[model samples]
Target: MIFGKKKFLAAVGDFEKAAGARDGEAAERAFAQLYQAAEKAGDAEFREAGPRLAALLPSVPQGPRAAVAVVTGACVERGADPSACAPAIFAGARAGFEAAADFCARWAETGGGELPEPDDELTDEIIGRTGEEPAIGWFTLPQWEMACVAMLGHRSVRRESAGTAELLALAERVTEASGHEFKCLTYALRVLDDEPLVVLHRETGTGYVLRMTGIGDNFQLHTLLAGVLIGGQHVPGDAPSAQEVAVCRDAPGQVPTQGSFNLAGPDGAWIFNEGTPSDIPVVDGARLLVLDPPPYRRGWPAGRFFPGMPGDLVLDRVLDEAEAAEWFAKVQPAKG
Candidate 1:
């Protein structure tokens, strides 16, 4: 009953081969057998394989499948034109599928634990929202496969509240399965709100305390902001100054500008911003800062470069120039 480590590895290789061959049927059979073996073995290693097994399986095209059923059923049940319901029904199902995929992928990457027992309450909620059973078929696909599905679904649902609702329904399942340990649900909830954003900046003495409003509900916005900040420091300006030109000119062959900011997130490290070459002291070697609606407040010392609203309460904190300069230096690329 004990499938040793070597045996497990062999089985995993077999599964991979099957997957690579695009033999979904064979892969499915291998995974099911592995699941049973792991369960019977009852060891930590075997237990760990459970999550991987679930991830390796194929995903069912739930959205399209659900859409077909809804359109057909609507015509008979409500005596409505299938054509009229096509768009709305398809949109809802698509959103649900996408949200589900995103949630699942996050789970897999962060260590998807054992699949939880079926929760009637959660399943009922999904069915109620989509008018069909939320099957476990989606969990069969690999994380990347699920991610692609979620991405397409996200595009379809963008700006549509019905899509938001469907995503919310999927969030409920994610919450139930993961016991809310993952941030996917949180991200999904934010996406659903689809609120307008207000960027927040505070002087950190070394750099500005960059925060945004609309992001409280948008996961993508948070991702975007984080990427920009971690990637590098940007000093916005209309023209390059002589001093900036000197810095780059002195460095000769260094280029002294145009680069990316690297930062870590809840997931891992990523590039935030890609900077451009420049010749302005503040803007030289600095990433360009573009405010959608330029800052509208002013209260700092006269002649001090104050972009955006000055004296505005929107900024969380403002770093002193010296500190900002120091921080920027640290993140700057090291000379060869």
Candidate 2:
């Protein structure tokens, strides 16, 4: 088969035009011609063609999901790298009228091939990698969810969920289901009446304010403590107590440079680091709560669980002292 660069480019142009116009029949015809040209092209020509084709993805027009699947399948079959295109493909599939999992299933049917399974390393690179617009979908792949559970303290995972509601929810679910530390639970805290909370950070000379604007009531102290202590893992019928926690009612309006805190309590349970527990003078308001660790496994798994973060906690953003204070002030003013 003789490959003509001019003809291939022309076919691509025509297909893009047809797709943009939402002319399914015309798009399909143009795509067929485009694929045929690609098929006839030599390896070098195909390699160059691959990215051009993939770049067309995350298709602009939501005309035919199957057609997008066919284009992707052709690229993979013809030796195009899946990673180069998978993110866009998956993003486009979900933005369409189908769930991402269902689109993946459709991809298999159309391509007669399986999607690449992203491992921990690759998942790190792909999930919420910066620079691109947020994909219009939630995390559906179990591999993605598990990776989040394992790398809850990772910066990419935290940044991805901090402002995005869907990803934030996924982060919460992953932490709860795996009995890992709930790192993103604080992001769920809403301001009492859509007012932003501003607090000064004690550590830095420069001052910046963190802003959180939402209207909802904060969770109860006991409920919040239970979520942190036991997560989704506890005895079948036994409820855990939030009483073993030491409360510091009056703490200075300062926070660590990290947006959130996870440290070992005096009793060895992980606790929220509001201030120095040992030396904090008795204040009138309860600002910090140092909780006792859960009891030895009664009905929980007995195997040695891999600790991802400190007790499988997620990493918070590193902020300037003032920034941290403002951040905490916005999302966690309910502590006051």
Candidate 3:
């Protein structure tokens, strides 16, 4: 190994100490030497310490893209395994480290710099998040207002890139929620100002652009109309599309599904699902209880389950159930 453990540590310290530079130069400088040294070092110690050195990226306050340049640029220089560096950067992105997201977008904008196809999960993780790969921060919207549904008919896609595929996934989910059988014709996904936007093609004309905006707890996103096309004419909208999409938070369209589900566990018991508009929607169709949707599971995933639901009225959860248990016995109802 060319670079000693102490040397790698020092480089990492420099990067940590110099967070969010006007430009990523300082961090890059520090990381550059360490990465290059690690690849050529003759001793086993140098090679072993490299991945550990890469781990420092996540802990830094910002400049995720800088950290990326440090790691992957090293790969470009002499072919080093940049996998371990990805999650560390991902952790930064999850924490809302601005530079991390920038780095992801930048990396996607510019491919992995010819670093061979992903070799492992870590590499794949980086690719997936960069918006270059699929499902990086991808979310599905359950409710889309009816008016805009018509445009999807002629919508055709050119390719899936960045936020493009994710938006398409959302469109597919929202279309599904509307109970409309359809397909996504993705054209391109471009991350503009950190937002993932997609452009779609139409049969009669060119197409339109749509963006996904994340707003709410749980994995939820809403679509925003950004651009449009009419007979090959590109008409960029100065204002956001008037269309809207939302989560149907009400108990169910059927309104107050009645019956006792008798959930098995009390502490961990909850039954609910993301409400997709289906005639026999699982989350709403006459069930006694509701549970929060299980992580990453889509079909009728519960938003919240009415645990120990023994009340008949919708106000019961706030009144009757609370009163019966004397949980809020002193509280009075609004009417009677």
Candidate 4:
């Protein structure tokens, strides 16, 4: 080994101290050193330490658990056999530590990345979550809503990425509560100004733009809409066409011309403004989500505060499950 076991242990101590204290920067620096030491210590040394690291999992907080998980992933990447430590790691992972479980799942599904599978039971449990319901965090929504669901479509991604696992779990819950033949498409996208884009429908003749005003759990609202689609049964993928944009039935004659209109005021209000119409085709048989779409205005530096500007847009209307289902059914069949 290029590094002594004493040096590796010292690095581990520093990392644990930093992580325990919740000093993010210090923990990051310490982990870098720890990772380097582990790398240089060779496969035999890492294999020997694996069980010890697993034993530490239950006693540490989330931060240290994640750090230890990273180390495990590194060991697997370098061809270390983790069988001796797999049981403890899996138990801790199921208890919480998403990062650890995801790494294990990714390795199993992909055949241990550039290496080989670490253990059999770990692989089976990881794969089981995908096929079975009632997995971790899979019961936020009531089961009745999703009784009749059939399909779920999401981004083809591994669980290793942050938030992916939770998102899938939420999808499972929502699907269970849908209670109808449903299809869901859920995907992540760029968040603008700490908010998700709620509506951006543009048709050759008319369309509109609506933005969520960081008001009242819009994130939850976003997820609900996904479940509402496909009969409220499957995973909702990212916004179709552009960046997580929603397509609502356009409200005819309600379109304001060239200026900003406050569809609602102060509390629970929709600040609407009309802009250039898009050349996109209108889906036949769909409600008029917007009559005349707004023009794209980059609101930053100063313009964001003005009404009708992208930065100033807020929620104007919310559709219940019935409304959402009706609107989605009409639009779902047509191209817009």
For candidate 1, the TM-score is 0.26
In order, candidate lDDTs are 0.34, 0.35, 0.29, 0.34
- The per-residue C-alpha lDDT of model 4 at residue 116 equals 19
lDDT of 4 by residue, 1-336 (tens): 225555665666776677568777876777678777775676665655555555555655553454565465445434444444444444443343233234434444654433212212233454354322222212212121121010011111121224434434544334343321112212221112223232322122212223433111222222223223212222222222211222111111111111211121112223332211111123442213322222332211111111111212344445555554443444322212
Of candidate 2, the 10-residue stretch with the lowest lDDT total is: 244-253
lDDT of 3 by residue, 225-292 (tens): 11122111343222222221112122222111211111111123322212211111112112112112
Compare candidates 2 and 4 on lDDT and give the better one. 2
TM-score of 2: 0.27
User: Candidate 4 regions off by >4 Å?
Assistant: 1-6, 13-30, 77-81, 97-336
Order of candidate numbers by lDDT, starting with the best: 2, 4, 1, 3
Q: Which digits, one per residue and each the tens of the lDDT, describe model 1 over residues 193-251?
A: 22222222222323554433222111122224433443234333222233322222122
Q: For model 3, how many clashes?
A: 26
Better of 1 and 2 by TM-score: 2
Which structure is stronger by TM-score: 3 or 4?
4
Error of 4 at 119 (Å): 26
Per-model TM-score, in order, reads 0.26, 0.27, 0.22, 0.27
Candidate 4's TM-score reads 0.27
Error of 3 at 55 (Å): 4.4
Ten contiguous residues with the weakest lDDT in model 3: 307-316
| Ranking of all candidate structures by their TM-score, best first | 2, 4, 1, 3
